[model samples]
Target chain A: MSTRLLTKYATPDESGQAILKNAMEKLDLSARAYDRILKVSRTIADLEECENIEAHHVAEAVQYRSLDRSGWAG
Target chain B: MLVKTFGAAVTGIDAITITIEVNVTRGIRFFLVGLPDNAVKESQQRIESVFKETGHKWPGKRIVVNMAPADTRKEGSAYDLPIAVGVLAADEQITSSRISDFMMMGELSLDGSIHPIKGALPIALQAKADGFKGFIVPKANAREAAVVKGLNVYGVESFREVVDFLTGRKEIEPVEVDTDAEFLKEQARSEFDFADVKGQDSVKRALEIAAAGGHNVIMIGPPGSGKSMLAKRLPTILPPLTLDEALETTKIHSVAGKLNGHISLLTRRPFRSPHHSVSDVALVGGGSYPQPGEISLAHNGVLFLDELPEFKRSVLEVMRQPLEDRTISISRARFTIDYPASFMMVASMNPCPCGYYNHPEKACVCSPGVVQKYLSRISGPLLDRIDIHIEVVPVPFDKLAAQKPAETSNTVRERVIKARAVQSERFKK
Candidate 1:
């Protein structure tokens, strides 16, 4: 017998993938930001009555990082 | 003739019934017994003066007043009305069979007017629990007692009115307050709103999250950055108080005598901002007779500590346990009492002693290690209990003067409610 990990929900579609990739490369987003963006995107999708995370949802979630204070002391 | 009437003694936010027994005999002296404090003992002079001014003759015979539960120390002048009534009834000035049906408490002025007494709510609650039909209190305290259902609360103006009501010459209507309707009607009217704040959208968002999750938050900023202003509006965005929470909070205020004769249910969340020079006992609640302090007074609401670093470290340290447990326990030699202290802690402090350590337009004057030392004054254990930390910067003039309206607290509150719904669903698993 083989053990397998359980996947709960469907993965994001192609447009969502493109938006996340663009945010990572252009904004130099870290892994934590990546997770936060996904969580926020899920919330945005839930708010918009969508069953899956969409590209516009991820874009809206990425804008919440303006308050991030990473390496501003120098 | 001998007569018995009832009053209540408050002990740690609860009330215990005290029986006042008055005996009039054949002498020309007066006596007051029981383990009463000086204030309770002083009720006799006030009662005598009140009776004389109200056109009632003081009994020429000897009078003896004994407060039951002789072992427990009764404090405060709340026993004045009961003692006076007992004397009047024993002297045959007011003959009524219904004197024992009501629990009466008030402080009597020399002019015979009834003054408000502390702990009316707890006394009313005890009356209801003990199967009393009605409670007679000062007009200022009637509504406080009226919050307790299944009990008639009579608010009287003078000792004459109490006499007339007891003798069935005049009927005094009990006060009535629809607690739920009043709470909903007044909860929407906050004096300070987030829309009035010109800028600081990020700080507002941080506050919204803190309010949603019931998390402790600390704001780090320089002076004139609107940290204190932002904290004051935080309560306006949090969830409205349920009727049970409002009653509980009102009871704590009633015990602390902070209601100041506003006898309505505390519909709005409390916002307590103690000064930096507050003592440890004043913050956490302790004394010879333990009373609710700032944290307990802020029950079901916000406790904002402005200039958090300036507070004595000892005072701040005393709040650590209650901040985690949401209740404070004060222990004495014979007993320990618990006061509900569940409050969201919102604190603000400048970055350094000079208040310009990290200003955008200004240079830092404090040395490198000074800022760290200033921050270190707030101990690690105290800071560990706070869940959120956000830094605030001054808003530019253009942002402040902009005509475009920012989001209101109601708008943020709606989103917060939805977020809380999601969190509750997730936590239910």
Candidate 2:
């Protein structure tokens, strides 16, 4: 029997956690944005052929929240 | 003598075959029967006029034309050519030996020229399914019907040409379309691109995400912030349509009579921006004879709503269900039909009534709570359905006059395609 290809990818590690914490504190991102960030980071990792979600991927994903800033509306 | 030929009736983008039978008996009056609407009943006048104009014999005997099954309603003058041909064959003015092999539909002018009919694609599809050898349609609808393979589509310009072909006196080659090559050629060209927009890089990034994830987006900004300009370019970033999607979209457009002469497959995705004053029935697809609406017409493409709050609340409310289901179902006492309404919604609106509620450099003129009131015009449910809410700021004079061009749509589309590929692969698991 042929083995099925695994669909799941590797999760974020410690460096990824630091990036997320930095974005949440600095950007004041919502819980929804937090989840979206992780998903986008995973995609970025997939694009780069990386086994784990890297810190740079998380940083790039967080940068997408340009509209989420509080100062622009005020 | 009695003769039988065929036509079709379109309902909700599908077609049902209609058989037209004509018999010549020993009398002087014409009798037309079988559930024909005013347009179909009036075909007798057109047919007689066409016969007189073309120098064809109008049978002196009693001529009766019947369209079966009598239970279904036959609308439009598409039956003009079919009934005329059946009468001619029955009167022995034209050969009848090979009449049953083809299904014919077209509107006949007084001078006997054939006019285009709607729903040619669906009718051709039904004819092919019903084992008809060929479909004879107006020359204008030839390319539309040619999209269907395994069916001989003969397009004629006038009654004389049709008679010449049916009598074996002349030959008419069936229209053929290389659907794939045509689709690829058309896909290479796009009318709008992101490179034209001077700035709003943040909004472009948000739209890229929305396109990649199939999420709906809303852009709120002051006037002249380029919200509408940005929304129009979203289709170029989304993935090109597959063949099945092109056919499905073409069928809806064909049934709507939106495909004009010599139009082949619609390779580019549609961008429909109906005015804000559109009614509830027009936006979501409903009527006595239910035709597809803007949302359904925008199938597999983008539906941009500029000045979203300017739309009547009830009209926006009607769109909520289709937005969720990706298909709008119209229920009548006789039948229920669903039109595909799957599309990317990109709505834009000014920040407030004064149009400068949150402008970076302009002071708000509206009252304290007026901005909230304006925002509340778009219902909570509709806002909830939209995943991304972007704020667009106008580009500065320096940015607008900058020497470097902004990123082109092709570059953004490449990343969107890659992201979509990743998502589909993930979903497969």
Best-fitting candidate, measured by DockQ?
Answer: 2
| Candidate 2 docking DockQ | 0.16
Model 1: DockQ score: 0.07
Error in Å for residue B300 of model 1: 0.8
The per-residue C-alpha lDDT of model 2 at residue B63 equals 93
Pairs in clash, predicted candidate 1: none
Report how far residue B342 has shifted in candidate 2, in Å: 0.7
Global lDDT scores for all candidate models: 0.84, 0.86
Tens-digit lDDT track for model 2 on A2-69?
11222135356788789789878977876656665666566566555566778887777666554454
Local accuracy of candidate 2 as per-residue lDDT tens digits, B1-429: 889999999989899999999999898999889888899988988998999988997889999998899888899999998899999999988775889999999999999999999999999999999999999999999999999989999989999999989889999999989888998999979879999999789888778877876777889899999999999899999889999999999999998899977678999889999999999988888887788999999999999999999999999999999987899999999778889999989999987898987677998899857876787788766765665778889898899999788899999889888877876776676
What shift in Å separates residue B414 of candidate 2 from its native position after superposition? 1.3
Write down the TM-score of every candidate: 0.83, 0.87
Error of 1 at B324 (Å): 1.0
List the lowest-lDDT window of 10 residues for candidate 1 chain B.
B420-429
Residue lDDT tens for model 1, B106-183 = 999999998888889999999999999899999998888888989999999999999999999999999997776777
